[model samples]
Target chain A: MRCRAAVAALWMLTVPALGQHQHHHMAPPVSDSLQWRMPPMDMSMPMMPGLEDALPPTQPLLPSMTTPPQARPGEVIPLADGDTLHLTAGPVTRTINGQSLTMYGYNGQYPGPMLEVQQGSTVIVQFHNHLEEPTTVHWHGLRLDSRFDGIAGISQAPVAQGEAFTYELYFPDDGLYWYHPHLREDMQQDLGLYGNIRVHPGGEPEAAPVHLEQLLILDDVLLDKHGLIPWGEEVPTHALMGRFGNVMLTNGVTDFAIDVRPGTAVRFFITNVANARSFNVTFGNLPVKVIASDISRFERQAFAESVPIAPAERYIVDVLFPETGTVAITNSIQAIDHFRGEFYPHVDTLAFVHVQGAEAVPDHRAAFGQARENATVTNDIDAYRSHFDRPPDKELELSVRVQQLPLAIMLSMEIDTLYVPPVEWNDAMPMMNWLSTGAQVTWVLRELSSGLENMDIQWSFTQGDVVKVRLFNNPRSFHPMHHPVHFHGQRFLVLEIDGVRSSNLVWKDTATVPVGSTVDFLVDMSNPGSWMAHCHISEHLQSGMMLGFTVEAQNQPR
Target chain B: MITLLPFLLGGLMMPPTPGVCVWTPEYYQIALLPTRRVPEARQAEGAAHVSFVESPFGIAVTRAGHYRYKLELRVSGLREIEGHSYVAWLATPDLKDYQRLGPMPANNVLSTEVYWNKFIVFITLETAAAPEDASWQGPVVMRGMSRSGLMHTMAGHGPYQQEPCTVYGYY
Candidate 1:
């Protein structure tokens, strides 16, 4: 076992680009031995100085942008079981990468304050909208009433501009959840205005073993020659691909460093909130065990060196630092430049972990085993296993195309254009990005059942119907792209990937469907409401690559 | 650059329908003009198909001079360009004047009113938010002339000044 750990460390140094090749193969088994560690190395990719940052959104900000007050991160008011928490949504001036820019925020914080509560406790949030545009907070990955689901048109009307609305949030399940604006989400969410929520179990065990915990919010911002790229209000900025950020951020800070004892166990609640970019995170010389995915625990923890998290997805992992050194957390993914049909290997450092002390913490040796003895993990196994025998109820295909016509011919065509409505803080010019928004219409999802593509109501299922759906991304497309498919208000089990039935039955709301790949999953349609299933990449969502379906009540006809 | 000129009525190969031709499940091919993206050689190789049907007096009688016909259209591989809209037109064989149909819908099927024989049926990509005019301004994408025949009925002498007399009754 020690020899295998040493070999793994040596392999990390010799074959630096192993991640690019290993993803094509099946995932490795979880290591039982906890000693496989790689030494520190230089955190720079081959193409460092010339990689272009993401361009600004289609529309630039006007000069008369609103600048609201900022909030302290530690100023969250603690609430008892049923108290009401007040939150204000407005603009705030935040400085990132030594530049100050105005962005929309909740309670004046870039990433809004953490709202913690106990399981089964119904809490009320006095959501006040103070921005120039309408906004609503969507509780991502939570099963709640449909009225508070936060979708603009489907769930409920958006909180009107300069108005107040109260949300009655009931937390039935215990896990990590998040909140963000739903209307014009590509603009509001990208420019801050996101936060996390944690629901603790009711019956807490006293004197639980002490372990270091950190909640890392992963995000990025695109900067152009004119400082922070402005958010598009009317038209999506990078419609070909999403507007990806160049500067990496963790917990709203660039230099997110942590000091810990040499041999202590640490748990990280990691969430990816970037608009388009996927964060493939790896800790130098540290092997982490993935304990939970999205909002629930896995049957058994799986150990991996690097894990890729897509937009609006969450993962909880635990790692024990054995040796004393400074290790950097790095992102190891190749971002495709859709315009030029090129790939840029973006391997950059995100944060640092410092280990100094000598002795291991005495109480945290059995932390991994103690964390899994919860009631939620035991209750979900039988419900998931019962649906493995049923065949898939439907099949769908995800497709994208890039077509080019002469510029003069495109300019001569008559198009039905939709403009951004009037806003005080936005520029008056009717926003138009002909090259990005008009050149190519890519990212389409087709349902074979109805032969309808893009925004078509594909199906209607009754509540409690266990359905298996097969999603295909074949090689016949004009260009290959990865899509993080998300289903609102439902949690599904990933049964198979590329025809390989998964041994681990982890529940996920958003699953990454890679290029030229197929994924089959089982969805227990438990929530009775109109839910949307679409790609989570913000640009693709804006370009009509989405569909909605209703889960009717059990007694009602579909 | 091979330019597709207006196909005169005499060159049509399909025989024209007699009276109130009922539309069927399938559509017959008309003109197939190549757009800027697709060249003449490629379209000739069957890259895409543009077909339509005419059902006279199928829906209603319009305020215009002719009886309203449901002009159904279908295009297999036609795509949506970002800043442009696809517009259909009905024009004379001599390229004299064209009646502007509205912008194409998302489903690629539209019901329009057309009563002219010996006319050309074509589609063009239009600029964003262009005026919904009755004239053709952009280059042609797919063009085909209608199956040629003479009109089945002439103007009737009535109180409505050479208009067809209304025979209102229950079917």
Candidate 2:
């Protein structure tokens, strides 16, 4: 422990002390509730010729914008088969943590109304962009047509200001999916403009004994006493580690609470909609059975104490509450404390489940105790296994490159290279991350086979082709941070990690490739359309770290 | 350049339904008949038709990936014994490992669906309580192989690489 502590001390001392002239040092404690690890902005000396050291979020908003009316919680709107709905994006005023703040919303709510549709049914959404800038709603995890996939520059152009676009969406798979802005997700999605889509089986609900269900959209907002710490007007500022929010929100609100009956099985459809932060969700550290992944149910259910969810990823877990006892639904993880020179447990209370009632009428506790064997997912993925052992058809390495970042930031990153954790639980260097804008930092997705980076690489495949792709998070880069990679029009199986084959498989559209880890997946090119794959970190995506691909239609018979 | 115009809905096809799975079953074929143990090894006279069913939603009509395979067989001239029952079994194409799929629910019909990729389906005559260990302890009665199971010709590898028989051995 002493040796490990010394090593952590070396990482904590990222900046050298060139004597008060210009040095990056950990500031004194800002607040008793939250400890800030950023360099001291008020420390007389500047961070080696940087603009001004930094702006701490604890400061009050100098010019506070008028908070609109208090926004209401997002509503659930269920649409029938072939229903047409109009979705408008506009500004909504919300009181976050006793401070009135302004954020974007769809249909005048913080989170757009949850749209519940049936499987295999087509619904029309006439989306009107009421915001100031252009935006396109990318259905996060759907196998819809290329046009309705909502990706700007690929399927269709962005909905310009005062323009409207109609989306004919079909929910091919019945599970939890979300929609957010594909253009400028760093600003649009971070300030709201996201919602859930729950597609149920067309016929009827399954016999799975789940009683009550909860849709928990997990998000985090970077806010200070002065309201939302301003977004970068130039380029995405937090491109280094993306924006790790200080305040965690559940369903776009703080102190969220739910009432549940004891001895009843509740299925929680949890989605991590945060711009950067990945959550390790735990319901008071109790056991929960993971039923479904992003696209569909897992071949085998996993019983886990916590679920690690990356950005843009969704997981469905069923929890059977005991007789009584309030359970705090939380995201608990170990965050690195550079100031204290150690790691500390950080638990954010996202919500609470008040379980104080009699057992449910039709108690599904017995059936919830057992997991089902799904033949469908197994058979669906059978074809992809053939390419599992062969050499990967394509390989991409994830890393960050900088052209002209400030000296202080570069010095700190170079020194801290000695110890970079597998998963960055917290923004250890918030000042450096906040200053590393898109102009200087370039998060790259380089194809190893062709030596092409980002947009320069174009991967093409035929429909029904099972393509194997390897994602390696190169640890030798300037700064290696875990990235949640998302593919637009395909569902993939996490085939293996590093060299070990993954025995438990689940179909997913987004997965977190941890720092220095190697992930191999098989993309089922069943959807024919121009698609894109990129890091889901909103700011990282803004830093030109994305690639486009094509899945040509099987225009002929096999 | 990316396509800017909306895709034609008519051009889109309704693909296979994304099926439900919480656990996977080993791909095995039940191809057995008890007549081999009898004098002269009598031939079992029966025919079965196996088809794929869509996930509970019944979405797939033209596409065929996500399917739960079902076999329906009606064999004539089957003698029923007092202490024995007809059981359906799934076995590796080589007839080595076996999994008991319980006794025929009703009549002389084996009405059930399986998810095995390539395996032989066979029937067996076992005591009322079939063996639990997937061991071959009963008399083989009938054997039927799927088209995918035929990927492996009796001649080893035979230039096909035999992936259909090897890689899909998912339990």
Candidate 3:
């Protein structure tokens, strides 16, 4: 009996370690051996009374009240004009103590509308642009036709003011995606123009019942004393770092609270819609499990102390409520200089998970099956490293500069010639009169090495030849460079940083390159297509920091 | 008029004046009408009645009935001024205040070859206290100017030197 008890204790200790290794998909037997070294103890209960042996096996409590919204198999939903969706964009307006302001919206909400569709289903949406200017909707992270890519002037024409465009989107995968404007995107998105999308997996429903599921669209918004700040208004100087909103909101509510029963597992689909902010999100005390990222589900559930979500990113995390109390999920980066003055810790409460009920639900850790058998290598790591060892196929460098010129006197002289003198001129003009400096500053991206007006590259490669890209942020400039480097249609491995490899490296479509830092990544051009590699920062891209290279079909084209 | 003379004299009295060149101001006369006219009538009648006035500085446009238009002035017959540019903006009727607009993208000197007929400036004038026109129109005109030296450009791009030029119109 003592030996049996020892074996049971050893099993408990090794479970968590095994779980981590399986989630990351380290090597096979090596990870198994590493897991056996740890022992698991019942951390939930410190001590068990003598009557523990007599206790019956705990059963999961009667299924919680909430359940995921049902999606019929092969279901297709069509969103026509005049269908209203109720949503709020920023934190609870009442707590904000500012004038009620309106932002870009569809069905009278900032995020337009949420369009939920089943995988392998076609969704017909009649999109409309009511803003004064032209804008187009880009279904971000969605695999769609290049013509429907929604990049104004690139993939299609902008939806003119008061214009409507129809979309026939057929989602190929089941995951979390989002939608936002692609014209003057930095300002429009900041003014609250985004929404969440969920494509449910298609197939027979699994037997395991989901108790509670919710969609949490997370965003930070800058608000003025009156309310939502006006578009085109001059922002503060520190905005170069990033713009931190005066208010933070989840699902348009500041202090949104959710109720959950003890031990009830809930799935949350979280999307960060902030313009440039990255969220370090955490639940105050409840432990959470991440199940999926932007594109696909992970091989196994992974637990994280906090999840880091950059702009236009999404994650799905499952959490089991522990006790009957308020659990706060908030942005964990409080003191970090997130561009604004000082990071006000817990400035916004994403959502509150309130647990209720006495009986504890049986843990489903054993029944929760793995989503994928193995974490398949999406990118070739060794080939990626070797590509980094050699020189890049091509190098492109860009710079950002700021200077002032005399504008007021020139304007006055023109006015005089026009025969109408301005009402107020010639008194000592304030220093802030310059356009773009205090009120508006224009940033330019100029190619330094090649005088090529257009950034179009043509290259030929074999099926699996790894292409290396080396991006350097020159230090001679004054402003710091924070670029979200993005590649189209493929994922790449960040092989080296400066010159070293990191085991914790993860595959990503976009990665941030810090100021004065050089980052190198390699992509196996297995997919033959003209792909675009550009800075994901919408403002920087608008300022012309973009380039496109073609992965030609081998032996087919010049 | 006396206040305007002293301001003009003060501008001319700069110790190291950078080769001053003068041009005649063009003028136009406009008539204010109580009712909105047809597009053709508004264009043909307004243009026919407009007059041009030539001043020592440049050309000024004048017209009847709250007319609004733009004037382009070009400075010619001067060597390229190094590191200096002409700054201009609209001023109040008393010429004591300036409204910032934007800078003219040209070199410091006004040459007919550079800024065809000097710089193009916009002006609007309205007789009614509240004009219903969708465009800019207000009575009372004044213009402002200053000659920026090369040294001024050397110091950190001349703080706020790019403030847009403003234009005023009086009926």
Candidate 4:
């Protein structure tokens, strides 16, 4: 039988056979209907008929969930040329800020471990899934074979419990990248299953003359009065704007502060791993230059006053503290009124840069020497200027809207409901888990021209076609949004904003489309495959805001 | 009758020129109509008609010698609007960054300079107090985009309605 949700079915088979774990099953069994396809990935509980209608103010707590995974510190299994490093995914407990939260990790490390490899070298990882649930490690932002894209159902099946898989990664470009579990990213990633990949250029990897090199895996953990909030058991809730972390964390540390010397340049590798929140990072009056973004260098250095780092985007910047003073690293968020009625401009200290010690020699020149020399490297905008004057081959509009009736209302009043005995709802707080069922939110995206929703193949382009695309966000949407539109297995240049030509062109796989703005890009369809272009915010993807596009290989006789 | 005759005669004298600048209903629909609208309350009170003209044919001009587009509006119930003032702005159809065209003149005929080829003429009712930025805030009263003798060098709908608007020139 052709199952619409082959992914969900494959995920179900990965559940542990232990009888004690059976009670955790909240997901409805796979059905033949098309509606059953594309079930929410983290939904483990079934809905009871009356439970939703009469949303009680409170409910009982669940028995202490399985002992939080024990800690297995990140271990470095060094790999020589043509060698493989063995990695395992399993339950682990990590204590941070005197709070021990049970979560899963790679090699028992909260952020796993950084995989360092030289450019032009190949590294293989033998991944073993030891967790009770299914999971797959997706090499985020890696330009590799589509089969190893790590997307469940589309790229490969979920790695079953006790199953082992191997990923042979070839580093063509030297930059920063990351890895995370593609299955239940909202849940797994939030708990911890993310790490960084640093691909240094070959031949001694001439290091930028910086006093200190810092790689910060920027993430957040939402906590309530009881400490770590209960995981969204049935479905990852906060479906509208995603669950914003009340406790801002960097490298899983609540109090993230770094030491630096005056007049010394510090190279910072920053990646936003939060499921949603976009951080507008700034150092108080510190002179800085953005050297690279998304692992690709900019043609020339651009002064960084404030940089908006959205989820899944990376930036490498060099900062020089002029004087000996503590410069606060703050996230200035403005114009965000999703839950709040008024636009509140807030400056939050995500981390602090305590500048101490004696002034050291600043090497700002060497920091940018490699970048400036290799400016026209692997793939840059200058190489594609020939097609700049040519007309765009395709135009696309990205739009989102809420359905007339809430999905929760429809599911509660209509559709079949599965009843769970009262005891199962308990988990520190019953109402908390129930709230995360994601019944109230039903957001949808469509290719405005075709009017087709989610996963529909909207367009096809031949390989090597220089396609210019105009992606405009619908201003009239019920809830206007800023989308970090990401294209898988492809890179493009942002040509213009609203109609004004951009002065500096940068190659990017993900571009942030502000609300009520049209961004024009020259899409170099060099990678041939069926890829996805969607909002990078985890909740948006879950709400069906993604679509498929194909790049057909040239010279193939069809 | 004497005052309205000059306005009518002025419009009739310059019978909309036929060229790349012709303003048809489709041009308005393509540029602005689908994206903006007058609120239901404003629509129920009275209808507003907005018309515009580009340079070479436009009657509006700036002191700076820039070709200013002429914008004329006949909107009722402005006198009834209290505690707030209506302001006009030029913005892209998506309503991104906008250029304030100043408050609506009591007489309603206004002229302002614009840069983009595809843009919407918007009138927003703002608080009586001064605004922080020149951009539009509060509810939109009327919205529209104009096509005139000026070159429409922006993206437009393709020959096939189903196709993406990849063509970025005058049809």
| True lDDT of residue A82, candidate 4 | 82
Show the lowest summed lDDT stretch of 10 residues, model 2 chain A.
A55-64
Off by over 4 Å in 2: A1-69, A203-207, A339-341, A556-558, B1-171
* DockQ, Cα level, model 2: 0.01
Candidates ranked, most accurate by lDDT first:
2, 1, 4, 3
iRMS (Å) per candidate = 28.8, 24.3, 31.9, 21.9
Best by TM-score: 2
**Candidate number of the best lDDT:** 2
RMSD of each: 24.1, 18.7, 30.1, 16.6
* Two-way TM-score contest, 3 vs 4, winner: 4
Q: What is candidate 3's lDDT per residue for A1-558, written digit by digit as tens?
A: 999988866765553222222222112234212111111121321111121121111111111123322211111223332343322222111223344444445444534566777777666567766566678877776655445657765567988876777765656666777777777666677656777777777753312344677777777665534334323322322123334455677876566788777767778888877755656667775555667666555434555555656566677777666667878877654332111111123334577888887644666544443332223433424335545568765444434544432343233222222222111111111111111222223333333345442244434455456777666544333343456666654555555544434343344556655333445667656545455566655555554556665554565321
Write candidate 2's Cα lDDT for A45-121 as tens digits: 11333434443322221112445456678899899989998998877788789987778889988678899998988
Error of 1 at A277 (Å): 0.7
- Give candidate 4 misplaced runs (Cα > 4 Å): A1-64, A68-80, A203-208, A335-340, A362-374, A377-379, A389-391, A401-442, A553-558, B1-171
The whole-model C-alpha lDDT of candidate 1 against the native structure comes to 0.60
TM-score of chain A of 2: 0.89
What DockQ, between 0 and 1, does each candidate earn?
0.01, 0.01, 0.01, 0.03
Q: Model 1 over residues B1-171: C-alpha lDDT tens digits?
A: 001111233244333343221122111235454445434223421111222111110111111112123456665456667787778787877678678877768776655656553467777777786788547666677766543221111112111112221221101
TM-score for each of the candidates: 0.62, 0.70, 0.52, 0.64
lDDT: worst 10-residue window of model 4 chain A: A417-426
**Residue A376 in model 2: lDDT:** 77
What docking grade does candidate 4 earn? incorrect
Look at candidate 1 and tell me the lDDT of residue A473: 57
Minimum summed lDDT over a 10-residue window in model 1 chain A is located at: A416-425
lDDT of 3: 0.44
